[model samples]
Target chain A: MATTTTPAATPGRTKGTGKPAGPPGRRPRRSLLPYLLLAPAVVLELAIHVIPMLVGAWMSLLELTQFHIRDWSGAPFVGLDNYRVVLDVNSAAGAELLRSFRVTVIYTVLSVGLSWVLGTTAAVLLQRPFRGRAVLRALFLTPYALPVYTAVITWTFLFQRDTGLVNHVLVDQLNLLDDRPFWLIGDNSFVALLIVSIWRTWPFAFLCIMAGLQNIPDELYEAAAMDGAGFWRRLRAVTLPMLRPVNLVLLLVLFLWTFNDFNTPYVLFGGSAPAEADLISLHIYRSSFQTWDFGTGSAMSVALLLFLLLVTAGYLLLTNRRRNDA
Target chain B: MRETATERWTRRIVLTLLAGFVLVPLYVMVSSAIKPLQDVQAAFTWWPRRPTLQAFVDMWSTVPLGRYLINSLLVASVAAIFSVAVAIFAAYAVSRYRFRGRQVFSVTVLSTQMFPGILFLLPLFLIYVNLGNATGIALYASRTGLIITYLTFSLPFSIWMLVGYFDSIPRGLDEAAQVDGAGPLRTLFQVVLPAAVPGVVAVTVYAFMTAWGEVLFASVLTNENSRTLAVGLQGYSTQFNVYWNQVMAASLVVSVPVVAGFLALQRYFVAGLTAGAVK
Candidate 1:
């Protein structure tokens, strides 16, 4: 793993030929040149991003309710009926589709906010040099690195009704509960997903925050400390404002990523009786694959895309405004 | 910088407790994997009564654990190799270039990261289905298709992160090379990249881990044939009776190597993480 990376990065570290491209025409060249430079990434995004979305948009308009497409000509062009079926509470699909959207919103907000605070706290505390910090830092990232399925499975096992470790400790050792607490399988799907999701996502927040914290020069704090200000004051006065941009970006990313995440809720609840727990992602999975309703599934996906596109546009606008203000 | 006694104490206590909190789930995974089935059935123990490798043995016998491990390793390694190579060039282009639409491109790239993978699923699945039908050369329901999908997720962040590292590299080095008659290409390769070794290592460990641990598309796109470790473990739920010990053992197999990877790539991983190597 270590070796594979070095060769790509070690391209031109040797002695150089000295005929420089002068600064004269550099300004004009740079204007068009950077666009050329970013051409590959734009092209890749077009392939991965624009094309699939266009395909989905087009597909959503077609009436292909079943899995296998047969009689395409006979299939009516039912424009937005699929969407109305999805949104109308009277319809079979609307109830679950709307439920999923509500749950997704709540889950995304809570998960992202909690993860950010925890991440920010950890990053702040671990910012300065300390003994055993290196090892602790690695441990901090463990949950994020533990793939979703593995973490979910482990969490489910720990939360099991009778023979789970959490129950043993909470009930047997400390007598925290009279009976085994229903952690994963209970009335509150919201609580269960929140616990596991927060635990798993904090590492991402940690990475973003710690990275930002490191870049904050020690001298800023030194100057503050010399003035006899406490840690909280310094953090509030200095750290928070400086980290605003990175935090915004991180928060935006987390909300979208966690919102789209399909597997976490699926692994925990398995589209079971408590339909309130179903997220939009899981709804898409079940609609398209399990129930074999591709048209409605494709419509839900288009809705998701619009919501995301709007969020991205808002975030970009805010960040760009901040950049301009700065 | 200054710490009060209360501050010091709270920090120490929270650190210790949080560390313990983090270790509990992992400890449960390890202990349950080693516990005997009868012991497991009776109750959860902080330490099992008679720890045995019975669960591991059973897990190996029952599921195709070895196949899943090999399949996951192959896909992750290949993706890491190809994606990092591509990420370096792509990151280079984004970071160094000062052209028109640069901001739009950067925003677009970041925006793609925000694009929900869920929305793309049905469309990508349909495309894969068509691929399988039209050409016998379909990458669908296989490692190849999965790798391509994983790369789409991996590439945006990798490029963004590489751009971050590129920004930190002093333009002086590149300019010095240019002054000494090197082209922009040579300058980027010779000067900019080697200085960013830590960043590259960071990207590798990150991309590898992302592929290694994700279950969303892995479970959806491929069925039983090319199942990865995460999907392999999910199979334990199929039987009406939950195989607690075996399932725990299977999870252990997945977590151990990744935890080991985290341990092995410590400084580079942590540094790169801060430097935007992983996200």
Candidate 2:
């Protein structure tokens, strides 16, 4: 009976023994110690990310503003009314909000996709370091580290219809354009933004994938080569598998960044006018900071926050499942 | 024992051609930055004929380039220090202890990177305004605010990287230390700290590069005194005219460190890139 009773206890003990016993009676509290170390970072990130999200959510429920400095009190609750105003077209705010979302998605998807392909290709090219490889790698990072205002301004100069390098090439040199195409005007507005977009962003993928490439073991390649694997075959089998985590991380990062991207687009295509190129960040700037419609701008922020939350949640779910498989 | 002629030729041709493609815009930028404005405006010239440093001269006197550079250096350094310091402890925790919230904490940090800055911009803007209003002292337009914000975004990556570095550190060292009666902190300081120097350096360099290069928050958050080199570049475009030569010069100015850092630590950066990545 005693042996059987002890044997019954073994299952729980065995499973528990697989993991170490953390500080007794201090499991929750012991964990809090690390968190205490983590407190400053948490507090800053909260102030930056979480609290604003909550506030935006809260603001969506109320008429929130910092327009006139004095009062700053919350108006009586109007549940989902801001969201209604945002989504409904008859309402001006709704039309603007809809515009913002449309532009935001376009910016996000294109920025993420184009940059990913370019960066990945660059990383692949860079997997081996030969002569001048070091210099070339350094050279490639220029687009990334160059100040946005400068790069955009440079883009602005390049895309300027007349007396621009691009126009000089397209019209005068190659004769691609009979007359200089107005690259920053109506039709070419977003196209100009896209050039700046690709130029500025492709480096992100380069950084992420470069990091990913480093993680792949030379031994794996050697073994595969010993088995007579080709370069493409090796990349497909070994490199891609190793790069999965960084790729996912980069995807999420690029998506979020492109979605929120303000500076490059804004500088290239100014906040006012250029509606074709204006992203949500620019739109929000127009509404809140420019138009001073605090309630609606806050609503737009809330909506944007929700969209980001969904994307991030989806990314997490996918990556988590992927890790589970591995 | 060696590559075939085909391999050598193919590598040479591909690499040389790609280098040309990469160098074109960069060459244009450098050429333009040194050229007189009229020369830049004229036909495409690979080499700026009669190259002068007039644009660089103009770039300095026209804007707060010196101040912005100082601001960038200061903010980047402070953010780097704060990021690395905070990261070391947090990274140690996440790596060493498999606590209940370990997974949650890591996920939170990773997810923080994916959260758009726009989501935080408005509320944080108000928060800063209020801080200014309340204390009669402000962080928003001050150098301090820039450092704070940079660290917030930067810490997560640094921490994430450091944690991966920490995991690679042999736990046997800790085991031996524990057997010899050294405490956890002692083990970390004596064993892990020395080993983690290279990674810590990489993280610091990364943090500096990020803070130095960042523009968005720098623009919105600090408009007046705390202008970054990036924000200062925007000054080239005024109400009526854009200073193309000067702007290109400024862009060249900003890219120096990232290029230099990569060159200086090319070996380490490549190595660290793969480090802390794989399980």
DockQ of each: 0.50, 0.33
* Two-chain DockQ for model 1: 0.50
Off by over 4 Å in 2: A1-33, A65-70, A74-76, A217-238, A270-273, A315-326, B1-21, B41-44, B177-182
In model 2, what is the error at residue B129, expressed in angstroms? 1.2
Docking class of 1: medium
Fnat scores for every prediction: 0.54, 0.42
> For all candidates listed, what's the TM-score of chain B alone?
0.90, 0.91
lDDT of 1 by residue, A1-326 (tens): 11212232333343333433444213224344445445655666776677777877877887866734543335567898889888898787888787778888988999999889888888887876789988888888888878778888888887777887777888999998897777655456678788788888888898778777766787888988989879888989889977876787788778888888777787776444256567788778777877766777888888888887788778779888988898
Docking quality band of candidate 2, CAPRI definitions? acceptable
Give the distance in Å from residue A97's predicted Cα in candidate 1 to where it truly belongs.
1.7
Cα-based lDDT at residue A141, candidate 1: 82
TM of chain B vs. native, candidate 2: 0.91
User: Candidate 1 chain B, which ten residues in sequence have the lowest lDDT sum?
Assistant: B270-279
Candidate 2 lDDT over B13-58, as tens digits, reads 7657655655666777777899887876666566778888888888
